[model samples]
Target: MRKVVGIFFLLFSLSGVTEVKDAHSASHTSVLLQSAYESVEPGRSFNIAFTITPKEGWYTYWENPGDSGAKNIFEWTVPEGVTVSAAAYEAPKRIPYTGLMTYGYKRPSTVLFTVDIMSNYTAKSLPISLEAEWLVCEEECIPQYGSFKLNIPVEKAIPNEAAADTIASFSTHQPEISWWDSRLIINDTSSALTIEMSEEEIKDYTEAYFFPKEDGVFTYSAPQTVVGMAEGLVLNAERSNSLNKPEQVTGILFLKTAKGDHQYFYLAPTLETPTIPKLSQMEDPIEMQSFPLWQALLFAFLGGALLNLMPCVFPVLSLKAFAFVSAGSLSKADRHKEGWAYTSGILASFLAIAVVLIALRSGGDALGWGFQLQEPRFVGLMVIILTLVAMSLAGIFNIQTGFEGAGQTLTQKSGAKGAFFTGVLATLVATPCTVPLMAPAIGYALTQDSITLTITLMMLGLGLASPFLLLSYSDTLASKMPRPGPWMEKVKQGLSFPMILTALWLATVYGDQTGQLVHLFAFVTFVAFLIWLREQMSSPLKRILILGVTLAFSAWFLGVSEKAPDRALSDQPSTSNVWTEQAVSNLRAEGKPVFVYFTADWCITCKVNEKVALQRTETEDMFKRNAIVVLKSDETAGFTPDTLKVLKKYGRAGIPLYLYYPKDGSEARLLPSVITIDILKEYIEGKGV
Candidate 1:
């Protein structure tokens, strides 16, 4: 008769009727609410337990459900002035499902909560309600929910031995605060948790696993490698690509003793500063030997020389060429002075940039080459400077230094000072273009000492200035130049078009960085007004004042522009097919050849490669023919640590990084910084690898 009545009550609860009961049963699971005390006492705290039992072969999730699954959620409805603490979960078991790992319980689990009663309570009875939800999973998942209600008399607390015993039985499953000192060391690719204990303390432990309370801390499916040391044990695991480097490593460490007993300990370990491993220590796919100092310096020089041919540098080079043309009539000694001055300017700029890069890196910033262009303010400033240079080149107005007597033209000056500033301009414009050997050289330099970095950058600057420097020294080469004529002015105006185009490109980059066009429009308008003021104002003092005010307003506008939203790529592909670590892994697992290219709006070489090779019809057809999955990692708005990790793994510090992963699970091959259509076809055809 009692069993029949319990069944009727279960059925009645399932019918959604509100009733004062201690248990609720669903199809796949059953939930029972039990309190340590039968009656509530004012101003006292008591514990309540929710025992969730899943049917055979089914399971429920813990707070962090590993790779995939939702944890149990509880919502309470109690009288005012009563407080309820958050539910505390038992240490979960590692449940392996196919290729994924999850954290949950296969059998019964108890979650405890503490309820505090107010001293001013005057009620005859205490009514408590709970809405509980959980996901039960086996081969498939089913979401289950239950509504439970209980009523207790508001009198002196009376201990319930049965309820206390039930709760005590599961107390062993709860994790105690860890006694061992633990520290977590994180790196670019992996993290290590080290627990300091005597060997005798862990002699009986056979295996260990950690379940982090935070999601995206480590790869859930990746195997945790345990290494035993004289001091203690260390568990090393792959770092998740989405890891944000939490302040503390909080988790539950589950240990299985040799006696088949499970011991759980709660850990909140201190996080040590992360250190990137030396390139020589990296595993396969990134297993290349470390770059020699000589090789790095040589590559920097060669790459810097090649940078002259990049599109972005062409405009600035043309200005230098015009200076050379005007210098043709000067004495050879004067020309030599100009050459040395230009070289000095290039060297100084390179050293200054390198110094800042080193300083920032020492301060724990993961910055790279051309990092300044990633700043919208810096990009906006470039746009303004370039626009001014373009106007000067177009002969819109000659910049008269009051010291130069107000009649001298900037181009015709061709003095050492003019050439020096021209060299500075060239270096500034050339930063975004990474020629063939520059990536590795820059990457290696960044990992080296300050002295090595400075020397390497100086070598690069020297190489960039070499061609003009040699030309200036050789009288024969200077004589080969055409004499100054009216056509020089035409050529100058034609060169202005490239400068304008470069400014437009930078403006586009600024827009992408800020996600707003209004600021850019206002800045451009200010530039136009400056041009008009220069043409209209005759007094030098008035022109200077107007230019200063306009510059101030432009700076203000840039400061107030809205920052771009963070763009995180989804695991699945969208219409644009942005790159994500998971997406690449999934594509490769499907036996498809994957092509990934890293780019940025500030990177001119990347844009040129896209226009000339990757975007070509033949390249598209080749990709389709090979069933290639193309993924793009664009770091225009800002650089992500994940993207930086991948770049550094391939021995690169900046973009135009291309990789081709074959369908046969072979090693991924790194492509060149600059790729042509034939090069893409050769790689896609498996001939280049």
Candidate 2:
């Protein structure tokens, strides 16, 4: 039957019949074109409507057919001086079939068009033609077309009462542009359109749904949750996986008032910034808080223990190891004291950081773990401290207290004070590396109370300080350490290189943040000059004066470098586009796969992943072959609110986030924090679990 109907329409379309006809019926539908006036005067406007009646149990589509249908098409041929406006549609009913929701007319529907006749005196008759095409569906879909022609005598206007009455009957069905105050609020995962209405206006409505004119605005199959507010109604809809941030939301809102009475209104609301809720308040799909509090603490402790292996923290741990080797000659009691002092240092430092984070958040700063590194001044201070430590270990300068019995350099001292400061330095450098389990633990901790945050962080610090503390306390562990000897000096000098490398990395972060390489160059040169002066001068008083001057100059330089330049002028990667919520949506709408990686210069793990997986030739080739759009969001400088919202949406508080959106409109897959080539390829190929 479907094939026969298709063949019949195909034959009729090719027949090229030029005879006048006002109505045609075939394929379970009837179409007719009628004018409001039988005759019209020049310079006056008239209404023409195309009335479509689908047979029982069948339907035809509206301008924006939801989910899976095409809209009706119309082509008009009129006189040269005449103007015809596009068709306007009435509000459509929600038609559900075969588990898919669609918008169309199940009964008779009219699409109205306006035509203006020229003012100049013309011929006695005006001929008009229309080629109409539409799709009608019952259990199957069939294409239908009609050729419509009509002639009207050009004379003073004469009303066609029947036609005028037909058009008037459906006029109230058309949606009116709403005058109610409304706004669209969008976050990473969902969107809500809020409309202000009086209590009287909403009292009768029991249900409501928004039908967006634009495709991909919302998931048509997803249920819309509506909440009644004191001022109005908020229709919360699940955002389509492939959608981008819309400039304005244009749609028809259908309200079911009193079951039989339905109201439709048009809405075009502008986007407004939404107030992001606390992490605990969000209904995150990833179930970030699924694990118990004990599990989170365990994760934090293990993550911190693993952080000792990171490049940024290893140099400081190496220094502590050297101190442990030297402690072999010291009394067991002194070693125990040193271990306790170091533990205290680690716990105190973590507590201090927790306090500061809590205070800043209470003041409404949207910060996360490792947020300190985002500040240029803080990065500058780390660079200076690391550089000085490197120079001291390299024997360029000695950090002496200048008291009678305090002649030993700081790094060479095996006392409790030196060990304590080493633990503090270790904690400082460890912030930039986010290892496995660390992101979820910290994300959970930050959402907790102050006391919980402090305790979780203390557990992490305990893990970091465990190895050296155990060595100091246990005789067996102490015996395993190499004895201090002349060779220790060469080993110390070798360790200086790692400190130098760490310092250089931090300097790069500084440059990336401040966009001022000249300042870094000058600071390095100044430090070199100070090192030279210390070696050349023998007078203690002059040396003290030089040290004071260096301190003052360093302070001034760090203060001056805190002012960052405009980010637009900063250097960024040329190969990838900057990540934005809108750009990602637009690309997805174009049916292109997208790979977006969130990174930062301060994040060592992100840099490692980029060098090992993202920057490889095979990865580039795969991307090019697949026509994938790659975007990079650098948070080294600072995170935009949208970026932060995205992070929170994925249950993270920091970067090294990798997301792969498939071209087939599947939910975006979150890649591993530490990605290898095989892992990335697997995710891109839809083979990941």
Candidate 3:
């Protein structure tokens, strides 16, 4: 439905709509104005949150003031250099009282608004003023007001720890685009509003509900239906017939996962119908990691360290290198600061991966490393982001956002994003390492419990982070380095080309996996439009909206796309035959030498074999010359009951399985799951394994 923005934007925009609210002590509540920033810098923006704390046993109202309570109001009196965004309120808990339903806070609460400080302000300190009014209720209602002013000092606009934590606590309840392939069934004849997530992700949640911030869309009193299974979940809410059917839909989805309850803000992902691609093309790569903890740790660390010098991580490395050099000189303290920051960023990124891995393991998702590149849409999104970053690096448009800023201007102090933030993102983009090389290590970790998995992943992170951290902190490195200057600019700009190349590589991988580029190209255009829109947005509020929406879309799209199938690769024509006991026995009975192989769509090892050996023109020619029939059995979407029986009979149940039966009726030979082209050629040439 084309609805008003969620409670977040509406809450901030309500500044002038209500009568002035001033400080006052009432029967059950009090009001006060506070800022999240300790001080404000010119040209920067900061948050000023309203603390509408009530006495014990009392509650305050939501922005919509659902059903009965009056909405809180605010008026601002600020310094001439200051401007404020419309107000924003935290998500409220649903409270049921004496035959009425209300959405509000029971304990001390906060509502926030943005304040922008003009760049021209020369004042050493500024007076900020705010007045507010709210209603507090238990069985009865009480009106309250407060007037507060604070002289905030003129200093670097650093964020305050407590204020950020407070905002995050309340904001966690807001709905966000955390799911991909999500849709709002707008024109459906069914009375319920339906939402769908990928099968792999939805099964994790047991209960869900959509809360419409605006009125007239959904009946607050109507029940919600939640259907979840191995594939995904579908949530339904009754449509309000009194209101016209919304062309689009927006609301918060309250979800309960293993981590507990959360409000994931759902902005419309796309109006198009989400396609259900086939299952994964390769057997999961990470599923093979079954080493003991010590071995897993050692391998993980080695794998991580190798990533630093890998071609895929080149772009990130260049950014960090330039940032380090531009600093020119660093004292002992400076080295310590830089080392810790970069290390922290890497570890955080690794932990995030662990969380997803653990959750998917618990939920029964058969995904491995590098599988993310299989999704055309996801690869396309990465292309968009990378292209934007390249443009920014080449001076096409300046990106003030954090991702691009991590490598930002090398001259900027401590590299705004520096090594730390870049390390996190870089590690994620390091998809190449998750395959054949690291597969055994990662796979072993995946099979173990969460604790072992987490420990193993941390080792990997430490290995990847060690080089940068050590380089920054070591005094000897400074003496070995060339002095920083204009030469650095040439290197910085040159690095953009490699990033663009990486983007191209991603696009090629997308085409290989999906065999389609329509969606990929479309997403690039969408990203360009948003970036252009951001450039044209002179107003801070406009910029915030554009940024928030774009980010939400990116996050949701990537998460969903990662789970999509590889249609082109998994469903492609190949020279191998599908395996079945009857088919194999019949061929052998016909006096034909038969070659049998087993594979699954989700097996990365299977995919490599397909490309390198089975699909080879020479291999097919040899099969024909020798009158050998090639057979293949697919287990991409997991094994069916019949396939399971076949697997068990073969003395092993996993892929890639290879068996050779000679025409002379000699016993069949079983080959290794991972076979080399040379070895396969030897077998085809009558050499026994």
Candidate 4:
């Protein structure tokens, strides 16, 4: 599919039927832009191209010219209506010319310049002169100048397909999204955009360019991109070493995707978050600290509705629907009653969760809506329930006699009970989804009185229950259900698939929270119990006995395991390199300048900065030459007390932290949350003595 899409666009480029005329050439070039000038209309822009056919050994500078280099600049001379603007530069690679460097194309190239027209005007042709200066070097730097006149008929409007496809093609080569790692994630709290690129793809590539779409979000020249991770060419880009989290980070990423003659743009990241802005007396920036009440309510409602579709909630919903349909021929009133009961169940559960969250918030428990699942016991309980569903479907256990099998029929009355239980199950599943979104809402609610918070929670509950309510009320929907028949038996059996799937999924969650080995043991034991339950039922009591034993074993496993510590190293990879207390202590003992990165895989911002700017050559060399002992500690899988103490020392509640220690080891200098190569170098070279 991707190949087909790429080819379709490639063909469009070949079909742009435009003619070219005047062609100029330099001493070292074979071909140049023939008729590259286009007239700009009032309030419109013209994307003019300057193509170069180099004779080899000649190149251009990217936006940044590195430590010592020059970038290509276009001196445009046009009518007042035509304002020349650089089409955001497709970043260039660093060409080390002698001891100096430059950023631009070395082979045949096209530089796109967007010219803006202030007002509408008419002309036979728009004439413009180009004074282009570039440092073309082989051994000695050669400064070159070009003077050319371009006269092209100005059409009333830019051609649609011709111009649209042209620009779109340029965009295809840009990075679509900026991410820290495999999963695409970008965040505002962090200062720099982190991007992880493949080593093979960037093997000959040596620079990172950030083209910001918004100002006030980031400061230019504060930092440069650096290489953080080296796993298969994975690297982290942080804000300059000095700045931590910027108010906002927004930009496009242009990395080297090919070698030699042909190279181009790969990604464009567009979205800027605000930093602390000066807004007189009444304006507060949008931070986790200052989420607005209306925004919170809106997010809560939307998030609540989305909760109905989460995988964890599906089983309960299925169980509910099965019960709802089984209620036999019901009067419209009874059906209405059942719908209200289900809604009540959902609302009650949400309110209960909200109460718990409020209490925990007061007690300072760091508790969120899904906080219960953080307890291994709760997760273990879910595992047992899933296992039971699986067993029942296979007809291995006589348990849950109300339902024939994992997906079997339920007695009409029992089915109604199932519907109620499902409501509860759904409430549990909805917690994780709601917490993150709710955090902002609740945090904002905290500024209001308790009544407002309660109302917010209520609104959230209403949204969550809306879908199930819709399913209940309409007779048409109920009638559309497959009539009670033998096929339900097969359908019931199919339900077991989801049950087993849930068990597996819950196991993964447990594993992530605890350890994989522990979950594996539980999975093995559950499977064994199922096997034993089959083929060994003598009487009802004996069957009950088997169930008891299974439950006891599961309970014992839960009892033996401790809730994984809050700071347990996370299963998710670190966004930055790991920094441990032991390593820091050792470094302090050795009197070496140490840079510590405390991060977790769960942190989206952490990952973004890692990929975009961290993984560059200059940053790597900076670390190496400075003898900067790099240490990292991840809290995703879990963290230890010592690590917690370290985190507290840095005054951070989460990951993606940077600390710089001087050789003298007075007090570690807390670097900004965002980082880059230049910042790291300055810290080490300027402060490390």
Most TM-score-accurate candidate? 2
TM-score per candidate: 0.57, 0.58, 0.44, 0.43
CA lDDT, candidate 3, residue 67 = 53
Runs of candidate 4 with Cα error greater than 4 angstroms are: 1-295, 324-328, 398-413, 434-454, 516-555, 564-689
How does candidate 4 score on lDDT? Answer: 0.54
Residues 1-689, model 3: lDDT tens digits? 11232232234424322211223344476654556777778998887767777899888887866556888878888888789898676666778542235678897777878889899999988676665567888766876655455667877876666567667765764445555555554332123334555555654555566655565444454344455433345544443333455555555556666455554555442333333221232233121111236666887888778778655677878877765665445555665666677788888878887888788768976445444444556566777877877777775666764333332334234453555666765776665443223444676565568888788878888888888878877677766667755666577677688778777766656555455556665766677678778888899999889989888877765554533363475576762366777787778778899988766443445656778888888788888888998887765444556654444333332455677776755435555545666777655563431
| lDDT-superior candidate, 1 or 4 | 1
The Cα error of candidate 2 at residue 112, in Å, is 55
CA displacement after TM-score superposition, residue 608 of candidate 4 (Å): 18
- Please rank every candidate by lDDT, starting with the best: 1, 2, 3, 4
Candidate 1 Cα RMSD (Å)? 23.0
Off by over 4 Å in 2: 1-291, 400-414, 531-540, 567-576, 686-689
> What does candidate 4's lDDT look like per residue over 182-219, in tens digits?
31222332243434555444444544444443333232
lDDT of 1 by residue, 550-592 (tens): 8788878768765587755563346456788888888877878
Candidate 2 backbone collisions, by pair: none
CA lDDT of each prediction against the hidden true structure: 0.78, 0.76, 0.62, 0.54
Could you tell which candidate, 1 or 2, scores higher by TM-score?
2
Give me the runs in candidate 1 sitting further than 4 Å from their true place: 1-289, 400-414, 567-576
Worst 10 residues of 1 by lDDT: 401-410
Whole-model lDDT, model 2: 0.76
